[model samples]
Target: MARRGQRQSGATRPAPQRRRPARDADGLLPVLARAVREVESAVERSDVRPSVRTKFQVVALLVREERSRVNADHTSSDAYRAEQLRRLDGIATILAKSAARETTLLGLLAEDAVISEAAASLKREMLIAAGQEPPREEPVSRPTTPADTTVRRVVPQTVVQRQLANPFLAPDFSSAPARPPRPGRLAGWELITPLLRSFEHAAASASKALPEPTTLRTAEGLELMPHQARLIASAAAGHRTFLLADEPGLGKTAQALLAARAVGAYPLLVVVPNVVKTNWAREAGLWTPKRNATVIHGDGETVDGFADIVIVNYEVLDRHVGWLGDLGFRGMVVDEAHFIKNKKSQRSRNVLQLSERIRTRAGRPLLMALTGTPLINDIEDFTAIWEFLGWIDETGPRAELMESLEETDLTPADPGFSAAARARVIDMGIVRRRKVDVAADIPARRIADLPVELDGAIGRSIRDAERELADRLVARYETALATRTSGSTVDGIDHDLVRRVAGWERSDRDSAKTGENVFSLVRRIGRAKAGLAADYAAQLAHSVGKVVFFARHIEVLDAAEELFTERGIRFSSIRGDQSRTTRQKNIDAFVNDPDVSIAVCSLLTAGVGLNLQVASNVVLAELSWTNAEQTQAIDRVHRIGQAEPVTAWRIIAAQTIDTKIADLIDAKAGLAATALDGSDDEVAASADFQLEALVALLTNALSE
Candidate 1:
């Protein structure tokens, strides 16, 4: 009897009965419908001027609408419910514009705002549909439909009235002449005095704790060796702070850490090149006292917790400035400060900016830059680096020192310009220590300049290229100058015209221009570089010890590799493409293994922070503009740990642009000390771009 209706219903009904669909208290369909309506209304009102209240109202209403719809249905579809909630979230994000005032909210709004708005809109819609108008709005304000109430949170018309002034943005009510900018030392006395006092206290404690130096002094507690202690003490006391420019294997990192610690500067920040970040961290743990030192990089925890020492690589420092500002870092150790010599580089600019912002509860923080080659073979390199370390002298010996160096000679008992410059610069607190001068265990360096003449055939070809290149360069220069000088009434000449002008120029060199016929000159230089590499390969074959060759051109690198390969010379190259891990591995094999004879590298990749004491020979296939660059390459073998004499051979193509460049580099190297001493004037006069030198080489070759 019971089965009779069931069988009939099965036959007549919509198919056989399947499982009943699941339902929420509020059906998914209603919530989704409500969410869609709110989105539509918000989009229509999107033209309203953006404000915090308007943004908040928009988001809140959307979320409330979603919640109401979800809560109302006894039966709902899962897909419909999920979609409605997602839509409600999106609505909340539009409303979040109200919460963002000072900080950028683009990412936060994109990620989280939408979800919140959807929920609110859904709830608001459901309530309105149930004949429950929210308390805040009057009867007239009530929404026409349940979905309209979902949009009630956002009141576009009353946005201005709802907005409130943030206290942080309020103007300071009290003013007392705003303390007119103070004078030197005194101008910052209020800030500097306390910091100096704190530094003094740290210095005293370090001295008291340090044990007396003896032959076995290094055996004592975590204290520095006597010589190292002296360097640290000097660096810690200076106003200009110190540039610990010690060669590799001389423990530059150790010296910097000890200097900071001796001054009771616990919250010290160290910035190094990317490759050395891990080394610095590990070194800190082994050498420094038991304290929290965090390395900020890749998957590392956010430095929310306090740390005694914070080590970061140059690549990552720009991203974590806020953390640094909050820490009130009292001391900064720029381990490879040379990385910032280019003012345009982010690390250099960022560190300089940080120097401007670093203020403790006590005063402005101290800066310490550590690099072996402060001058890097160029006088301007010193200027670039010294300015970064706060070594400016407006009226003192540093300024007068620059004036004296311009004359280029010295008289008896005059305490020459270089001396005065050193005193003034040193007074500001930039200390430069040389391993050869101070550390005796370090081996002596033997350097030689090898000048070679190209064969007549190649030389003549190179000369022809130079003439063609120079003509084009001059024409290009004149055209550019002409266009720049032309009044705005006339449209400027195009690059093609400039090239034509350069091609037509009669002179082989242009004094006013930096580069000449780039295409021809590049080709000429390329040939010369190849010829020089062949010459270097011939010379290196005779060398006994393992040799490290630093090349500036990839052409030279390839040419040299060919020579090595053809001659069966076992060699390894560490160039830019190799990962840091691979680079280190290759360098280690070259330095440590007797079977491997040579390590070829690019000047840029192996320029700094490398230890190559195992080899006694360094060869530069081409010259760089900066002396420090050459010195760093040379120092790879000449560093403190080398036991044998370090020999450096620079292969120069005589009477070419190579020779001219080498001459300028040599001239600049002589002025590096004075320049570093904070005197730039005389240093500027000694070095000049000599287009005539290039022309003479060209003319001589043409005559040949």
Candidate 2:
């Protein structure tokens, strides 16, 4: 039964048949073979123009399409099929080499990269030249939104009065940036994608080259830490924009307010989270007393029309975005800038629009996007942050960045372009300093996870809720897969679609309200873990003298306080709703009063402004959505004046969503570590982590 090409023996068979290179006489193979060679030569010569990149992508796409066609052709003989695949592999090898030579071309090979019309048109021509009609191409539809996507927008009467009072303060286009008369060297090479990927492979120190510290410039007896002073000096030296991403508890608020003062960015506008809105005014007075500060509350009825610094929270920003944009504020600061990572969200749009207005109005405003979490989820997080700082825009690098790349004297086709590009971007005022970088100025801190298994009925409910959420996610995923019209079926789990479905569940108000969501599930987990966290806190209180317990929900706080009372332990309660005096009084009691062993604090309120270095031991009853939040809570005790090394006891529920979120946060922490600390760990995935808990864990354990 042996075939003509093979002969069988008792112990041995004829040598396996060799796969000869198939002739490219009659198919798309000839066109792709020629195209790949062209691409290779173009890249080798450092002439990888946009058209050349398009050809490379087309050749790669056609090779894959033809290989699939050859393997699935029932009429073709097996020998012919094998030879065809071998030839296709040869073409693929050339494409790989070209990508290696011009690394920026590698982005076009990614699965998520959209196929441009040029590439599609090129593919059609190649297939037509092979005497076959090409199929019609359908455009990929992304989630779209309206221009004014926010639910509502309003201008307060006081804002209108302020604007009327300053009628001469019309927008000053004289200072707006003019477009370059001619295109730069690397004009149309899709530099944004390459620039973003630059960070993923980054190893250089994250911060910009800062000037040495100047003398402390505060009006009061307040003094700046050395690292803080260096950044202020950079601003004083006329650096306009900064992605000031020092780790939490590094006093970013002080730096920002003082930076505005250094530049005399009067009529400064600061957009921050609601929890820290009041603290901005307080810190402004403390750091730069010469500058008057006012916080805009509901409708901004009491907002000082002529204050030197105007502060507004993100929640009410929608109402004020109108007038804020109209006002000619010389400087703008977005605190917790990560909140605007999702560019489609109303808040993100508002922030971007205001930044644009500021750029247009002021010649060169002092724009600072302050966030300790350099990346909350993924490398793409840099897009919005960069746009807010006027580095890059929707299409590609704006004028300033384009000019920097031009000075590199290397195209995307040239060797070492990515690194050079990253360095240029860093030079554009990415001031990242970790606490470890200033460890001499501050004590060392560590976060340790304590896995606690939930065994009782409460645990059962949490597990059940978690299962329900997972099932819903899976069902949605399957439905999406089945209904997908685009014939692009992936081999395994489509993590992109899973992320999309999870985002829909989280953002779609109707669906999120109807079913059990991640928020409810997390709250349930926190409620269930209250007693266990309290017990651990009680133990720590006895051992370490004073322990700070942080919880997100009031019910969890009440339960912890009840447990402490049953054990007859004295504790102080601090909450978001508490008045300033009351909150401070409780904090004073916990700090000065030795008998108060634990301070039951709200993670949202007490996490930011309070100085609880009196306690070295801290217990977390609930997990936060972002690493920065968790770090903020722990940093309440990890700041200056800590006598010993700090430890954060993260009470993670084993085999639950709690553990997944913990790992995700840990992965995101690598962004700051690598970008800021210049450590070995690479940056993690996008912040849109929801259903890929298992995927995250595996990626964390394995190399990319």
Candidate 3:
């Protein structure tokens, strides 16, 4: 680099000569070697001194030797063949870089050679004039090989020809035909047309039919973030009934309330999970005017009152499905609509039926749904909920909806559909935001795995037992994992397989005398405990900033708590059995206290909107087949205000059925790629899991 820079600064350089060196593909190797030997021999001769020509000869010999070795074993060895090919490609790159630097050097050298030759001729003439002997001259010849070929010289071009040379290198243009424009008020407005049309209509409607602009108030006391405003504006403009699909802790409820104010379309009904009814009511009162919002906890009088907004839970909505119409609500919002994703469920049926009644008076009352895990495990889930809300057209039941989603037979060759039509349908109604694209300013997160070693004596016994019954165990494992069977059942069989293979469940009566079964059980327990501890330690170690550990089972939570307690790790738990008050208090402590390093909780208990941005790590002790549940759990740490990038890590046992289920869950959730544009975690997980491929793997395992 220094030498190159020096040359660039217009420093003096060595001259070039026509007698430089002969270049060849293979033929010049012998000549180069002879030149090198002669130079080396002369250098070694005490009487002779080596010249620049001798030094170049030596360098050329070394180059020839290296090239010969590269090509010699090119066919016999893959490494050598690759090396030779690499060198061939590298030559052009090296030459291109070298040409720019060496141009002046070469030109100067060539010119100097002419001067040297002239001076030598003058000296010879003087020597002959003075009656002295003239110096001997060597013959000059041009190189015959590709390597020695001089750079091609071209005649200077006129200014016009130079100016008109191609403007830039050719661009890679797509061969696909352009899409026909969608018919709309702003049809020719290009990419921003949809947003423009929606905004214009919203603005016009707000101006013409709503109350005076001065009558409305910017939300007081409760400060609105920029993203919150974007969410509200987008909701008011995009869908008649918008789904507040932001992740947990992003204040979807706040956005919904603000949007109601924007459109003057209140006298609204807010439906959420039973557990969060009070939280919603409290937020509403704090964010909006006191008398404008009312919470309906099985209160008929309160719901019937002419309040701006009435909030209810899903459980109550199902119970009073038809009665909602009597309230004369202008809009209805569904929170956690994933609960109603199953078309046959009572909640879904009730919501669908109630939608009809609510619309009867208000001209299809604006139906908005809120969910973080929108497309839980399948596209059919979306179809089911959206069709009910009139986001998409309803054909019939599950079978018909599944057909529209094209879960199976989606290939272009499948005569049932065309790719163009599918793309068109997908373009509408789905607007997703991911942690990576929108939440990129957040910090980085990581997950690490730790392996534990077992005692030699116990390990040896387990190994011996496993080896003796290897074939039997494989058969049993396979039989249990059949596609016709449930994965939980398969997991149960694998558990038993491990116990028996490790000789922890002996049936012999005499075996009890030496306490063999008891000892083996102890060993087994130790192994399991070690595995769990190792996983938790690795995850907790990665949680230096802030972290949330999710425990699906009480035993798992107990184990994690015990481990943390023993290690003196600071944490608070929101167990499944805890009261709502206790849950909230602990959550507050985790988020407010700087000393609190981790917050452990049951996924089901804390899956709703509970902002815990104080942490950046989320560890899932176990996985659910439902992507919605998993997503809601992960979003606890990933929402707005999180200073760090949130990472959700899962601890999976290698070669276990748990690994397979985790893979399937990840694949199903990965369909949200469009929604999660910059999500590195999502991209990595997508590569790790393939639901269809996993099912095939399970099938193959069962058959084997």
Candidate 4:
């Protein structure tokens, strides 16, 4: 069998010697065709051991380079050049279709994307196949002086003192040895895809049963729910790692802390989103009062280096990861694990690197990844989560999972392998239970979409803006089709063309602020609807005791707050610009003070972590771009302790893109339901939402 990282010997053998064309077209066409065929086959057969994403990136990068070359080749005749350009366009069309199947691949086509070593090697091989010399690598120069080359970390005095006080930290590797691969039918295949596919194909039922607990209460006098207790018991019984994916408001924070206590995994480390850093400390105090907890602020001005528990946010992890790794933390917990879904992200890299260090220093330390929605867009979202729990690494399954897969003695081609593979991973410790399954333990929650009509001149202007955006996109699409060579047109609207046009517009929208793209149009609609939504929220606050109002833009929040003030309704504001202390104070006012009837929140700032169960009704003044953000907003009010049924009033504008986005959000929500809630529903990936929304708008405009 070929070893890992070894290039396939016959993968891209050079094409047979032939007369090179005057222009790159003759030399590149056959090579591009062969490369595309090879990549498509690899993707179809799942033979790219590292990742199909890498191959996709390679194809995309090559397509971009070849297109530039074909367009600039001046030596060829006009007729010949046009013919070559058409063929190149055909290859590009194929690349677009491939990317469309997997929405994540579209991100690799960005202009500033960096080429990895593997991708560069593949590109060189393709160039060799085309009988062209690849570009020469530039030599990297080294810094000459120590002052110029030395790397330093700005360690705080307190952290330095702690490290100096305990200088002899030993590495621990006593958990278990790497299990030998057993003789089986699936002995040498790339198993990650098959493993992930198992989750995709398996029934979305309640997760497998956890071991029964020996205790039901914490030392702090807080009673544990049956499900929470089972997880604690599992940890107590030596199950040191878990993907604790119980739905929100199910006491996940309490369960994680108590589980640490059960295993004596103290000197614990908790990495959470910035909004929840303070909340983690609060939860630690409530559930594990005996253990001292400290929250690290910038520069650690008042950090308690001696505390038994350390809580840090993702934003500041880079500065503290160096010392935290040396502090000998016996346990680690990452809240909102989905934040690390993109493995290339800096936060994800830092989290994974720190987790690796913890494993080395405290062998078999308790590690947990807690999130309500683990699979946000695709099944592969589980990759980072699994890595955090130490169940799998980038290459493939780690020790424990490999042993289980070996026991199965089956391959992806075998019958019933997916279910068996899923069971194995779940058995490793994936605790998932939805609110509906434990409805009696938590308040019932529902999302009600409230469509409001805009009938004034302002409404007509917003509608006109939407029509103009759609027309612009349709014009671009038609222009692209008209420029194509004859006989390549299709009957229906080319959805691929639609996505490309949308992607180009979205790219332009991101780089420039003046354009009226989908983003700007949506913001305009939000601005137009702000008054109406705020008025509705004020009415709801008067009828219902308290209301939590969420909006995306500062102008919308400003408008909402002004309207509330004008109406004589008391409201508290929580925004991203406020300091930690002020933010916490505002949150406290909203939760504890009954006189505050409304909590006007910035959806991006107050969405994930702050608990606002004091309010049973939530008014979304503007729509969020993703379903996760929307759900996180509503969960603040619908969590565990609320006594009444929770309702989220999503104020969407009628006869506009707002309605389409709301529908798209609902469609995307099914992904989380299928993965975490065990629902058997078909779902579109959230990555496709932007493109699909654009398609719907353009199709609407064309029909009109």
Which of the numbered candidates is closest to the native, going by highest lDDT?
2
lDDT of 4 at 380: 90
**Lowest summed-lDDT stretch of 10 residues in model 2?**
4-13
What's the CA error at residue 261 for candidate 2, in Å? 0.3
Better of 2 and 3 by TM-score: 2
Better model by TM-score, 3 or 4?
Answer: 4
Q: RMSD of candidate 1 to the true fold?
A: 29.9
lDDT of 3 by residue, 1-704 (tens): 34423322431234232121223334433433444454444433422221322233223323544466567764568875675557543442332222222211122122112222222323333333334333355222332233222222121122123224533423223222223333333222222122212222221111111111222235574456455666555545634555445554345677677766666556777777543565566666766664367655432334434467777666445335544545556677777776676565445666777665555556535666776653322445655556555544343222222333344334333453343223323333333443444464323543322122222354456444433333343444455445434446553335444433323223334544533332343334334433354334333442243578776666667777766654456788887688889888898888888877778777778887688777666777656546778878878776877665576756543333344555566556666655487644654443332233233333444345
Cα deviation of 546, candidate 1, in Å = 11
TM-score for each candidate, following the candidate numbering = 0.36, 0.47, 0.34, 0.48
How close to the true structure is residue 474 of candidate 1, measured as C-alpha lDDT?
47
lDDT score of residue 496 within candidate 3: 44
Instruction: Tell me the deviation in Å of residue 663 in model 4.
Output: 38
Rank ordering of all candidates by TM-score, starting from the highest: 4, 2, 1, 3
Tens digits of per-residue lDDT for model 2, 1-704: 14312211211223354332333458777878888999888876767666787788788888888877887798989999899999998898788767644544655675545566556656656765676656644252232233322122556676678778888886656565757624867866888888888778576667789888758646666877888888889998978999988765567888998899888888899998654565577778778888889888656777887788999877567667887887789999998787787676556888999999988888789999998665323778769989999988888888888888889988888879988998899899988876556767754787756666564467778888776666676777678889999989777667677667766666766655556777778888898888778866875675447889999999999999977876679999999999989988999999999999999999988889889999877898898877788889988998887766677878777778888898788978776666677666544545555545534433333222
Each prediction's Cα lDDT score? 0.52, 0.76, 0.48, 0.75
Worst 10 residues of 3 by lDDT: 203-212
Compare candidates 3 and 4 on lDDT and give the better one. 4
